[model samples]
Target: MNILSLGRSLASFIVVYGGIDLVAVHAFAPLRSLSADGLPRRRLTSRFSAGVDLKQNEDLQKYFQAAEERSLAQFARDDAPAWLQTIASLPFECTACGKCCKTIGSVYLSSEETWQAAELMNISSTEFIEAYASDIIRDSAEASNTWVRLKEKEVLKGTDHSPACIFLNSDTNQCQIYEARPTQCRTYPFWPNLLASPDAWDAEVRRMDHDSESTLLEWTPDAGGCEGMMILDQNSTTLGVPMKDVYRQLREYRQQDRYFPTGDKKADTER
Candidate 1:
């Protein structure tokens, strides 16, 4: 490589040879000779001729190209960088694996929502409570804060507590009362509780249900950490309109406080 080809008043670069860093120490001694590895040393004077020979040296060419790329990525404005945009889309899409609907905490709805859901199903509120819901006190301070809690059935084998929501269709793995579903049902995995960490996108920690519970781990801590997550790209679904509607409903459910999870007083726990 012609190091002095770059006509400049002052220039500095490191030439890597045999894993050793050889630098031009001074104008008098442009480079230190090292013949231990059978590589001839370079010595060139720093004199300006208004010409740059970065193209001749592949390493220098790559260095300047990478430097230019980094500057653009760091300084460009008005829009996010390409990599940032890709990351923003991450841990967000719900493939409707229906896992969240199945493996979930208690699903509750306001009294108004209960009535609306009941009416949509062409049933009286009294019958709805008896068949699908139970009354629960939302707040202990006042007796007026009562909400309807949806029941869960079809417990996952080997786990007593893991049950699918009662409204979930066993045949299609889709919500039966999707349009008329409760507000709580409307705001699903989007719950502030799950937003505490990006890691929670797996629908509850690193264990994203490796197909079957048996393959979760194998004689080691954090062994299956790389397993795929529950959420997926919106385009990953092939269920057509039904699946598309579910994603559309979720996007509409996003509230102003969607970024914050529960426990922060400013966060609106109920969407």
Candidate 2:
């Protein structure tokens, strides 16, 4: 390859590897550094749900890719957890409850999302940025980086109290941006399940009901079909939706939680 091409490749390798190293170092640091497991964790805010913070676990790809690659065959072999089985069997359809969309979170836009949203609204990306970007100052950085959140429930001088989602159309209780909706939304129900940590699973189950543990454990493998869900692994990502990409999106929110606490005033801001 040309010198320029080789140099670019090396730069990319450095950025990715360096970032991975940083993530690995911090993965267990908080738990170890403070010597307090009671440290407050980031909770879900707005209309968005939180998932695994893969940035904290540089090895996350191995597990997620495993789920994507192996079929239902390997689930039992790997000693996969029961939550995946329970979710696979449960009828967890969205039901278009609109419960989720009504209270939206600060929506982070992907590069593609930014472009598409601009196109859909027939507005310049700059205009979109001005209207929806959330200001975040990274502690590691001197200057603030621009990020976007979904518009609040109320905009347009109080005339539009509708959910500010460009994709949310309450009239139909549907996401106009459904197909293009962030990967985060598509992985619901299975998310906290796919995350598969015992602590994380227990906490989420407690939200749905206090008595879910026994049932969740029983449904994991032999009886229910959720074992099939565990079939997702790296190879699966290659064929369908990339699991790493989804985890990356969730990781951003996870990492941001360090700075933004749950139930903070900003979360309660009137739409």
Instruction: Give me the displacement of residue 146 in model 1, in angstroms.
Output: 2.2
lDDT of 1 by residue, 147-216 (tens): 6667777565786545667888878879887766654555454443443344444444234444456534
* Candidate 2 Cα errors over 4 Å, as ranges: 1-68, 71-82, 85-90, 120-123, 134-146, 155-166, 193-271
User: Tens digits of per-residue lDDT for model 2 on 34-95?
Assistant: 11121112221111122333334344434433533342234323444543333323222234
Each prediction's TM-score against the native? 0.42, 0.39
On a 0 to 100 scale, what is the lDDT of residue 156 in model 2? 69
lDDT of each: 0.44, 0.39
> lDDT of candidate 2?
0.39
lDDT at position 205, candidate 1 = 28
Q: What lDDT does candidate 1 reach at residue 29?
A: 17
Return model 1's CA RMSD, one decimal: 23.7
